[model samples]
Target: MTEGKWDEKFVVFLKKYYWDDILQLANSYPDQRSLEVDFYDLDVFDREIANELLFNPDEVMPSANNALQQIDLPVEKKLIDAKVRFIKIPNKIPNRDLRSKHLLQFVAIEGMIRKATEVRPKVLNAAFQCMRCEHVTMVPQNEIKFVEPVECENETCGRKGPFKILVNQSVFVDAQKLQIQESPENLKGGTQPQSLDVDIEDDLAGLVKPGDRVIINGVLRSHQRTTREGKSPFYDLVLHANSIEYTDLEFDELEITPEEEEEILALSRDPEIYQKVIGSIAPSIYGYEEVKEALSLQLFSGVAKHLPDGSRVRGDIHMLFMGDPGVAKSQLLRYMVKLSPRGVFASGKSASSSGLTAAAVRDDLGDGRWTLEAGALVMADMGIAAVDEMDKMSTEDKSALHEAMEQQTISVAKAGILATLKSRCALLGAANPKYGRFDRYEGIAQQINMPPALISRFDMIFVLLDTPNEDMDSKIAKHILKSHYAGELSEQRKNLPSSTITQEQVDGHMEVIKPVIDPDFLRKYVAYSRRNIFPVMEDDARDHLVKFYMDLRRMGDGKDAPVPVTARQLEALVRLAEASARLRLSNVANMDDAKRTTRIVYSCLRQVGVDPDTGAFDVDVIASGTSKSQRDRIKIVKEIIKSVGEKHPGGKAPLEEVYAEAQNQQIDRQHAEDLIARMRRSGDLIKPDKEHVKVV
Candidate 1:
């Protein structure tokens, strides 16, 4: 109960079970000034000792510190402060679950590190010298504000005069502040995550980086929040970290029950696992089987590789969907948001570069200190980011993703802060065409209001067209009607005072669009697979990819021509195959996985990059706005117009004469007309009148 008795008890408890560990720590002092002791170890030694520290941390912590200082060792070197860190607390609390009752108690909280401030020194003990009598007094600083002696300590000079702080005689320690938020995977439904501020001191400073899933053991303390209106009654809670440890697997943050783990393992062994998972992607949407299948692979991402040359290759697959309206692009995006373990859904229309990556924000959160805020992409690290209306993003905002997509990192150099944050998430973007509808005759880059350079970064680009087909339309109508009916029934049951519909009746109606795997189960399955499975490429799979690339390259070997497919697509194939292998929970990607992925990639290319004139795949079609054939025709038509204008005395070419010249050059009149319109749109030519044009 008393302070000295409490200190003696801590010394006795440490000597009983940790005498050898203390000797080892003393031997390694200064070099290893901290001794990490588990709370369970103390509980096993004496449960009362653990309980006393957890309830009365303020008194017990210093007792443990004194016990460490009192340990005798053979080394002649004086030990610089030694720390006893208590870890492995059995009952760890979530960030959101921390309550007012836990104040001043030793508690363990688990979450992802969202932001961290730079390390700074805080004075702990200040020695002051009074100018009146040269008397010295020591003051211990406890709060955020510095402390100074009020008067001289000598009896002869008890003056209330000024005293100067002895800076050299004062002791200081490294301190850091952190913001930890609950991991996205741990959240259910659409619940926003809760965060708490933490104050780490001494050796614990700078031990963590942003996006790290860590379990921190510390005492919960409260500080009064000071507002512009002056000191408020509300107190803000912050954890004073005593020990920090990284969670072994990112998936560990998502607590998977034993029954759920069994179900996941069993599902992995199913032969129809891939189809079932794809069906579970966006079941409410009528069709887009290919798109849903690709999204399924996105959930089970491939393992990233780090080469010996100090370079890295990202394994995340990036997909872009450019389509007409009412094609369920937004619905699919929202579904992926729930499927991926840490997915973030953001609208490109409202997202800025700083909102998607990282920002150096100056706010009252740190009392005017610049704080680095983690954005959507940084917070969704090792997960998926689904951006709807991707075409609506500003040019500068879209450019921020170039490095995040490829290098899996965001480098910030604003407000005198230079820091790189991890953003290793797969991007799933959906955009609409310029004219609000997909144009099969036009290039994808030309149809969408996005730069060619940004468009080419996507691993696969699919064009979803809303074409009228009798059979497809019937199926879509039935699917939409069933979805609407199910929704109406659910809403009616909720609104009615006394409902005739039983629970069984409601379940039967909802089962029509129910996913093969429940959302919760699918989340756990994806997390387990991502955390445990890292597949390798089999020989046959490797050969399959190699032959596909070689065959596409051979198509460009006829003459001086551009390559049909770049090596980027090859990497995409590998990532897709590995994801397929993960669905079966296999360590090696086989021929079957390779065949499925190859077919998917080939389909994507056919949809977006195929040159209609040559009937061959052309990478330039997607990388730039036009293929070689289209570019050549545009050149020929421009030359003809230029030549016709030179022949004319007025320096203008008539539309009819330009058409005739294009016809003489073996160009179709209709094709020439389209090219002329395109040139006008691009500002390459000026239309003086309906019948005539002038070269710009």
Candidate 2:
């Protein structure tokens, strides 16, 4: 059909199906310049027109806009430049699947916004004035290159040279560029994700930001590849976006069938559900039942609270594992990533601060304009980010995680771009001890390479020591051998004929190493619980948590006693209890949930927060890198050095004299020497010579 016929059909279709919508648009003109038309509605009206709109949007779009302009309305309410945008396009395609056939075709693609450029005015129509004739001509701009009038339309003057743009008469629209990447959850088998550039104009320019998951309905357009050599035969694809729909809910992408929902509900009702979940996580790996239990709770995280004051308290849990070499820390992290609804795994040795958080990068697709690019944490929003070799990251780079872990947001103010991106994900970080082996006698803050402030933010810190024990070693060896045997048998069965290797024999071997629940089912269960369950703490549960916290605090009531625990631990306990209730699909967190969380918290505290010298629970060891007893002893030693230095000529106390005075004050000689060495390393004391020391 001709363009005029298409316009007439669209006008009739709109009047029949969208008359009320057109009237509403007429009332809200200028502010809302675009009218969204559903593709399904268009299909219902005329199937051929719907098909043409998807295949030849460039031809049909303008005709639809012309039809919209022809609609009858009040004299002052008539729209001249109103747009007709299509939504719910059925031709959904993945980023990697887009090809030449899809170019210029209307399609819907869903992904997380990996990068977005700032909105800027783009010329849509350029009015050129002939310098010689002083006549203006209007030209529509479509391509990347600016267009100018070919020749003057004056009856006598037909000059083609020296045309200048009339700035006041040129039409401009707000335009922005975004790079959308395949959502991490959608990629499988370690496949690298692909991204596509999207151009949005007018009302759609500033509606989305980096880290937002959206489905963009647009027409795919191709641009010739250009380099320093010249334009190449190959072309790059870009989407001309018409509408943006946010998939903001964490589990919106996850689809649970009715049968699967029944199975999930049945699993939640199982009396042994907790044990089954713990056993399902890296079942091939031996022992650390408590650690597995904590990890299970982390999967069904606490409810995020939004206070009336407009501040948000994050419910996502952050956990750290400090262990020796040969442990299964990395394996556990990998398993968690696989089980999460959306996950990203990155190693600190390879990831920079920007790679782990967000970066302001120059976008090649946007003519070298600065854009905000999301990093691992941002991409894993409402999911899990498993970071291995966390200690390998530089202190400067690790500092970037402080805000992301607590506030669940990454604020970037670099390269003339300032933006805050969401990183509302649980962090499962694995680190190696500074000395390559965890020391039970030393504080966790001293053994781990991470800063004390950062370490303190973790809800739980587990120390996996590779201690040599005959019974435990034997068990671990048996488990590893069984896992290998299971794998060998499975491969043999696959290669051999059915008669040679019976299925029952392979199943017997597999049972020893197989997960109690399938990983895929576990992932769906986690997503379901996170989507539906928001457990409220019952009074009994609240009391249980308060009582536990008060009892710990009572241990440090004396004037000189160390603080047993802080309010942070209480908050962590509450989150854990809520997660426990969520795991059961319960609406209320009761005393049982509270008790379970308290037990886990107590165990974690005993491992990392105990003071070696005082043999007491002192959370200061983890929170401040120093126990209260150690701090007091250091203070006494400093006083002794000051008093003894006055008698010396250089005001530097002799090492032997300071130690003697420290011993006289009841501080151990060896402990005093260690304290002095620690102070020297920390820059609080300077060794004037080998035998003398001076306070800085």
Best-fitting candidate, scored by TM-score = 1
What lDDT would each prediction earn against the true structure? Answer: 0.85, 0.89
Q: After superposition, how far is residue 668 of candidate 1 from its true place, in Å?
A: 3.5
Q: In angstroms, how far off is 87's CA in candidate 2?
A: 13
TM-score of 2: 0.76
Task: Tell me the spans in candidate 1 whose CA falls farther than 4 Å from its real position.
Answer: 1-114, 121-138, 154-174, 179-249, 252-265, 363-371, 488-497, 560-563, 664-666
Task: Give me the overall lDDT of model 1.
Answer: 0.85
lDDT of 2 by residue, 602-683 (tens): 9998888888887789988888888998999888988888889989987899999998888888988888989998888888
Could you tell me which residue pairs clash in candidate 2? Answer: none
- Which regions of candidate 2 deviate over 4 angstroms? 1-113, 118-144, 148-176, 180-222, 225-249, 491-508, 638-669, 683-696
TM-score of 1: 0.78
